[model samples]
Each structure stands twice: as C-alpha cells, then as structure tokens.
Target: LKFVCFNNDGIDEHMVWLIGLKNIFARQLPNMPKEYIVRLVMDRTHKSVMIVRHNHVVGGITYRPYLSQKFGEIAFCAITADEQVKGYGTRLMNHLKQHARDVDGLTHFLTYADNNAVGYFIKQGFTKEIYLDKDRWQGYIKDYDGGILMECKMDPKLPYTD
Candidate 1:
C-alpha cells in the first residue's frame, strides 16, 4: 500500500471507493448525513491523505487545521471494509498525525468519533470528552448520536505519534 495526498489524479477512484463503502460508513457514522460526508471528501478546502492499493484508494483520512488555535480537526477517516483489521487504519492515522504536527505545527488533534470508533481512538491515546462547543459545531452537536469528541495532545510519548 502507498499513501498519497488527494489530487486530481486519484479523486475519482477515491470517490468510487467511498461509495462502495457507504454501508459500512453509515454504520460507523450514523449521525453524519451521507451527503455531508461526501461533501467533506470532495471539498477542496480540506486536506486529505489516501492509501492506495493497485492504484485504487482503499483507505484515507480528511482533516482541517485551525492553525491559529493550534489544533487540527479530523473530519473523516476510513478503510475499505475488506481492508479493515490489517493495520491500514493505524498507518493512515499516524500519517495524518505526523502531517498535522510537522506541516501545521498543531499541538492538539480532535475528532468526533463514532461509537464504534471510540475505542480505536482511545487506543491511539485520545481521551473522550463531551463536545459542547456549540459555536464551532452548531447544530451538529445536537444531530450527532453515539459520537463523542476525542482529543489527543501531540506529544512524542503518545502512542499516536510513535
């Protein structure tokens, strides 16, 4: 597997891969509307990193940095259903974390993790927190279910960075 930044060359294949994973995505992210998820992936404003196998996107992550706030928010991440449990997710996340740290100088990382993903985030050294930042999340907080905010400090000692 190879990791690549999202670019015009691979966006179409990535979109197709995401569509194929829609069912799994719905199960993992029940609170997020499908349209919103697609929008996040297609939006050029956000940065994305993709894992490709045989020239097809099999896993990836999307994130946005709030540099002034010293934090980066992970918008979405997933591995193709067939690709799960092979450590690809961990590899992708580590890449994202390093990108955030080295490129953005972000000291913290935050993400709204689905219930099924909470444990994974915890294992990555994130701590759970009730996300009540209405100003930033707005109605999303109310719409979200079984999802909670998880955060990690970008310390070298953390498992996520190692």
Candidate 2:
C-alpha cells in the first residue's frame, strides 16, 4: 500500500492510478457528477494523491495548488465505500498535506465539504473558520450549494504523514 501523486504528467504508472481513482470517486460520491470528476482528474493543472493498496486505488484527493496564494484548493476527496472507516482516508489526507507543504510549499489547504463529509473533514483537522484572505480564494474556488467551505493551516514543524 502506497500513496501516488499524479499531476497529469502522462506518466504510465500515474495514469493507471488515476483511472482507478476516477472510478472510486464516481462510485463513492454518488452526489457528484461523474463527468465533472473525470474532467478534473484528467486535467493537467490539477493533481491527485491516490492511495494504492494491493495495487488497487482505494482512495484519492484531487487538488489545485495556488502556491503564490499559499493554499491548495481541494476539489474532490473520497475513498471507496468498502474502504471507509478503515483509516485509509486519514492516511490519504495526510499524504496530501505532506505533498502540499513539502512538494508545493503551500501553507494551507481548503475544501468545500458537503454535510456528510463535514465530520470527516473536521476529524482531518479542517475548520469552518476560514482564516484565509478573501481575495486569495474568493474567485479561485467554485461555490456549491449546501456545501460548507473549510480550511486547514499546515504546521511546518509537524511530519504530517507520521
């Protein structure tokens, strides 16, 4: 079991993992549009950190880095229904946090979580109190009705993956 970060660079290994992640998201997130998930997963500007266990993609987090703005906006995050409550979600998120901070030098992470996912995000250290500047993320993030926007500030001192 490992975490793979794909930036749509067309690498053969990452592409395979991306396909698995797309399928998982489509299956796990019944309320999200499949077409939307596919588009973002394949988009070059966006990136995904996939959890591949036993060579199968059990989960992933899709995000866009705004390094200059110091935050990476999380577009989609999900784990397979069968994999839920098994700690894969936390590890996937921790890996993403490590990538956002170590690889991209991002200082914060943000996401719009639906009601069902608020609890999960909260457990992952995200808060509804967005300390981010409005101008930095105002037009950058898309609004979804009934979704609550949350933010998580990265602590440079912590090894998030640990």
Candidate 3:
C-alpha cells in the first residue's frame, strides 16, 4: 500500500480523496456517527495519512497538529477490518509521524484512546504517563468522556518506516 497524506490545500481539488478517506474511516468506526467522521475529515486544521492500494483507500489516521505547541492530536485512526493484522496500521502510523515531523515540525503526538484502543496505542509507543507539560495541551484538545489520554514522543533519530 502507498501512503498518501492530504490536507485542505484546495478543498475542491482533493474532495474526491477526502470523501474516500471519510468513507473508510466511517466503515471502520461503525459506532461513530458518520457526520462526526465527516466533520473531522473535512476540518481544515486536520491532516489525514492514508494507505491506499489498487487506487482504493484501505486505512488512515486523521490528526490535527498544533505546530506552535510542538504536538499533534490523533483524531481518528483505523484500518479496514479486512486489512487488519497485515502491518498496514504500523506503516500508516509511521508515515503519519514522519509527515508530522518533517512537514509540520511536530515532535509529539497525543491521542485519547478508548478502552478498546488503549492496547493498540501502547504497542505504537504511546504511554499514559504524559510527559508533555499540561499547560501546552490541556485546553487545546477536546476531552473524550471515556477515553484515556496517551502520548508518544517522536524520536528524531529513528527512521520509523523501517
């Protein structure tokens, strides 16, 4: 699968891609309202890193980077149920982290993982012991009702894709 990242550079130009990404995320998150997924995917501040194969979007992570804050918040992360366990999730996340670091100048990632996702985030190097100063991300991100906050500090030396 090829990794593709999209932002709201020119909404009109990338509408088709954004739509497909939205649909894939929606399917993966059947419990989440489709409208909510649409809002996040289309938000101007958010960027989506997707895994596409045979010209079809298979998985993606939608995140919003707070550049001045030196971090990015993961809004949505998922792989098609059929595509899980094949390592696409890892590749997708590595691409997102690299893109955030190189293009957005972000050095950390924060995510609110519900019970079901906590283990996955842990495997991706996220820790509940948030090292980021509370003052930086406290009021910036929306609090999720039943989600546990996790943080991942980007390592500058490692090539994540490897």
Candidate 3 residue pairs in clash (backbone atoms < 3 Å):
none
Q: What digit string (tens of lDDT, one per residue) describes model 1 on residues 74-139?
A: 887777777788888888888877777777777777787887888888877788863434354443
Worst 10 residues of 1 by lDDT: 134-143
Q: Which candidate number has the best lDDT?
A: 2
TM-score of each: 0.74, 0.96, 0.93
The top-ranked prediction according to TM-score is: 2
Provide backbone clash counts, one per model.
0, 0, 0
Candidate 2 global CA lDDT score = 0.90
Model 3: how far is 69 from its true place, Å?
Answer: 0.2
Over 5-115, each residue of candidate 2 has an lDDT whose tens digit, in order, gives 878887888888898899988988788899999999999989999988888888999999987888998988999888899888999899999998999999999898988
* TM-score of predicted structure 3: 0.93
Which residues of candidate 3, in runs, are more than 4 Å off? Answer: 11-13
List model 3 lDDT by residue over 1-162, tens digit each.
Answer: 578888866766367777888888788777778999999898999999988788787889999999899899999899888889888888888898889998899899999887798988898999999999999999999988778999999998688875
In angstroms, the error of model 2 at 15 is: 1.2
Cα RMSD to the true fold for all candidates: 4.3, 1.0, 1.5
